[model samples]
Target: MSTCVYVQLRCRPGTTYDVAEAITLKEIHSELYSTSGDFDLLMKLYIPTGEDVGKYINDHLLDVPDIERSLTTLTFKAF
Candidate 1:
């Protein structure tokens, strides 16, 4: 089964839009949004079945340059 995760990203000053565009170009996230908080961008993604969640995220999402930090929340159940 696919794993659903929400990732919160912190970007370098003046680079949030660049980071967002880079991430969007990757075509990996199910949805992406700009938020007000410790983090700048929030993304919801489905980790494909049989893939290692950590590795998948590291390779695909976290690779975006100018992203200063990331917090990943894994979902255990829908309700």
Candidate 2:
């Protein structure tokens, strides 16, 4: 089973596009979207079972340039 997570990204001013591009280059996210509100982007990630969620996010998403902050939400039971 995979661990599903939703991550909200807060990027530096005018850098949302750059952040999105960086994310695409990583090729780890299942889905990503631009949004309004406290966060600038919404991303859905699927972490392989036994993978460290925090570390995966850190290396794949948080480490990307232009990402100022991130909020991660874990999901259980779809439905």
Candidate 3:
């Protein structure tokens, strides 16, 4: 089964849009949203089976420009 995760992105001031667009272009996220609080965006994604979660996030999301930081949370049970 795929690994489900929620990633919170913190972007450089005025660059949130740029970051969002870049991420959307990748077409890797299941869902993404703009939110208030410590993070500018929240992304839901499914890492394919056998993929390393940390490396997957680093190789995909972390490379996008304007993304200053990220926090990833792994899910256990859906219900």
Model 2 per-residue lDDT at 4: 95
Error of 1 at 78 (Å): 4.6
Q: What is the lDDT of candidate 2?
A: 0.93
Select the stronger candidate by lDDT from 2 and 3: 3
Q: Give the TM-score of candidate 2.
A: 0.94
> How do all the candidates rank in terms of lDDT, highest first?
3, 1, 2
Each model's number of backbone clashes?
0, 0, 0
Of the two candidates 1 and 3, the one with more favorable TM-score, higher being better, is: 3
Worst 10 residues of 3 by lDDT: 60-69
For candidate 1, what is the lDDT?
0.95
Candidate lDDT scores, in order, read 0.95, 0.93, 0.96
Summing lDDT over every window of 10 consecutive residues in candidate 1, give the lowest-scoring window.
Answer: 59-68
Q: What value does the lDDT take at residue 62 in candidate 3?
A: 96
For model 3, the stretches where C-alpha displacement exceeds 4 angstroms are none
TM-score per candidate, in order? 0.95, 0.94, 0.96
Which residue pairs overlap in candidate 3's backbone? none
Q: Which candidate do you rate higher for lDDT, 1 or 3?
A: 3
